[model samples]
Target: MTEKVIALDIGNVCIGIHPERCFGALGFRSLADIPREVLFLAGERFERGEISEAEFLDGFRRLTGSALSDAELRRAFCAIIGEPVPGMAELVSGLAGRGYRPVFFSDTSVTHMEELRRKFPAASAVPDGIYSYRVHAKKPELPMFEAFEARFGVPAFYFDDRAELIEGARKHGWNAHRFVSAEEVDKILG
Candidate 1:
C-alpha cells in the first residue's frame, strides 16, 4: 500500500518568478561579487526573522562590503533555488488526494519568506500555509520535527535531499526517502 506524502519546497521564491536556477548559476559564480558568508548570514537572519527586508539588505551590504541592491539579491536567491521539481503541484495535490497532508518545510529566514510570499501568494507559502520561519525550524532538527508533529500530526513519510533530515525523520519514526528525483517519488506512489 502506498502511503500519503507531503511536499515542502525549500526555495527563495516560487510561482511567476520568471523561471529559476539563475541565482547560484550567476550570482555565486563570481566569488568577488558575493561571498558564501554573506549569503549564509542573510539566510540565517531571514530564517529567524531577526531582520526586516531593509535590515537584511543593509546586513547583506555590510557582509559583502558590496553595493548589491534588493533586486540583485532577489536574482541571486532565485538562482540558488533552481527550478521547482516538475509537477510539484500535481505531487502535492496527489498526496492530498490520498488523504495525506502535503506540507512545505524550509529552513528559511523571515525576510526571504516574505519575498516568496510576495512572489507566490497563490502558493500560500507561509502564514495561512503549513509551516514557517515563525516556527523557527531549520529542518532535520528535533524541534522542527516535534513542531510538525504537533501541528500536522505525525507525518508518515518525509522527502528531502538532506541526510540529516532523513536521519531525523528516522529518529522520529517517519518513512523517509532521500531525494533522488521525481521518478523516485513516482515509484513510491506507485
Candidate 2:
C-alpha cells in the first residue's frame, strides 16, 4: 500500500509570520539598504547550516553594523513568527486520524524553528519535520522534495502556502495543494 502523507509548510500555513517583519525590526528599510544577494547569501548560509548562529548574527552585524546584543538580535529575528493558524491543531489531528501522516516541511532555520516550537508546543507534535537548516535545501527546489520522497516514498499529498512550492511538488508527480485556510483543507481532506 502507498503511504499517504500530508506535508505541511510551517510558515503562513501552520503558523503565520509577516514576510519582512524580522528585517523591518532589524531596521532594514528595504532590500536596497542591504543588497538582495548579500541577504540571500547570509540567509542561505545560515539556513543550510553552513555557519553557526553566532556567525550568522555576525554576518548581519557586518552588513548593518548594528550594535544589537545577541539577545536583542535573537529577539528581532524571532519577532516575525507569531501564533499558530486558527484550527491548525484540529486539522492536523483530523488528518492523522484518517491515516494521513502529518509532516512539517519548512524553509526554516534552527533559531526560528526553536522559537516557534517554544511558542507553540503543539507544533512539536508533528511526526517529522524536514527543516532547511538540516536538509541544506528549501522548497521549490527538487532536492528538498527528493530527500522527502526518499524518506517517505513520495507523499500522497503535499500542502504549502506558496504557489511556487506547490508547483514544484507537482512537477515531482505529487498531489500538491496550495493551503489557503484550515477550513478549506479540512473540507478537501475530510
Candidate 3:
C-alpha cells in the first residue's frame, strides 16, 4: 500500500491573511495606496529568498516612502498574518492520525513563516513542508511542483485557494482542489 500524502497551502488555506492590515499598520489608508504590481514584484522576490530581510524592508520603505524603523516595519509586515482558519489544526491532526502525511507548501517569506509557525497551531502541527523561501520558487511555477514531486512523489492531494495553483498541480499530476473550508476538506477526506 502506498503512503497517502496531503499538500496544503498556508495563506488563506491554513491561516487567514489580510494585506490591508499590514498596509494600514504602515500608515497606508488602504491597499489601494500601494501599487499592486510593484508590491507583488517585491513580495515575489522576498518570498523567493532572493532578497534579505533588511533588503526587503528597505524596498518596502522605498515603496511606501515611510520613515519607520526596522522594528516597526517587521511588526507591520507580520500584521498581515491573521488567525488560523478555524479547525484546520484539528483537521491536520486528524488526517495525520488516520495515516495521511500532511505537509505545508506555501509561497511565504522567512518573517511570515516564522510568525505562522509561532502563532498558528495548524502550521506547527505539520512539521514537514516545501516553503517558497527554502525552494526559491512559488506555486504555478514548474520548479515548485518539481520540488514537491521530488520530495514526496505524485498522486498527492493538494488544497489551495488559487485556481492557477490548482491547475499547476493538476498539470504535474497531483490531485488538487480549491479549498473552501475545513469542514469541506474534512468531508472530502474523511
Candidate 4:
C-alpha cells in the first residue's frame, strides 16, 4: 500500500499572495529596496520565531520609516494575501476522497497565519498546519522537512510555488511538484 500524503502550500498554491507586494505596500519598491541587514537578518529572525510579532513590527517600522499605526502596519503586512484559488475547496475534498490527507505546509509567521485563519475559510479547513515559526525552521532547510517527515511522514506529493522548496522536498526522497494552477493541481491529484 502506498502511504501517501498531500502537503499544500498556503501562499500562491491554494491562495494568491506576492511577498514583494507586501513589501511594496509597506512602501518599498521590492525586498531589495529594504536595507540589506533588515531584509536578511531581521527577516530570518521574524520567520524563524526568534523575534516576537511586536519586535518584528517595530523593526519593520524603523526600517521602512513608515508612520503607519500598528493596525495600519498589520494591514500593510497582511495586504499581500489575496483570495483563495478557485476550486481549492473542491480539490481538498477530492484529495481526501483519494485517501490523501491534505495538510498546510508553509513558511509563514504567526501574525500572518492568524490573520489568514480569521479571514479565509479555506485556511481553516485543513486538518493540521506545519508552519516555519512553530518549528523554528523554514523551507529549503533540511531540518524543516525532517520535522515534517517525523510528524506526517514524507509526503507522497508536496506542492509548492517555489522551486527551492520543491527541491528541498525532493532531497528528502519524496515526490514534489511546482504548483502552477488549480486545474493542474486537480488533474495531478486525480
Clashes of each: 9, 0, 0, 0
Per TM-score, the best of the predicted structures is: 3
Write the residue-wise lDDT of candidate 2 on 81-168 in tens digits. Answer: 8888888877776665577788888888889888878766466468687878888887777788877877777777778889988888
How far does residue 5 in candidate 2 sit from its true spot (Å)? Answer: 1.7
Model 3: residue 16 alpha-carbon error in angstroms: 0.3
Cα lDDT of model 4 by residue, 100-150, tens digit: 788889888888787667656555457687888888989878777877878
Where is model 1 poorest over a 10-residue stretch in terms of lDDT? 11-20
- Which candidate's lDDT is highest? 3
- The all-Cα superposition gives candidate 3 an RMSD in Å to the true structure of 1.7
Output the lDDT of residue 47, model 2: 78
Q: How do the residues 1-190 of candidate 1 rate in per-residue lDDT, one tens digit apiece?
A: 5444464544421222222243343444554456677656555666655666677767777776656677876656554433355555455545545666566666765544555555443354223333445665566667777777777666666677777777877887887777666567668756
Indicate the residue-level lDDT of 49 in model 4: 85
Best-to-worst ranking by lDDT? 3, 2, 4, 1
lDDT of 4 at 17: 77
lDDT of 3 by residue, 18-108 (tens): 9999878877788778877548745788899888899888887777678999999899899999998988878987776677888889999
Candidate 1 local lDDT, residue 108 = 66
User: Over the full model, what C-alpha lDDT does candidate 3 score relative to the true structure?
Assistant: 0.85
lDDT of 1: 0.58
Q: Candidate 2: where are CA atoms >4 Å away?
A: 1-3, 30-32
TM-score of 4: 0.87
Q: Between the candidate structures 3 and 4, which one is better when assessed by lDDT?
A: 3
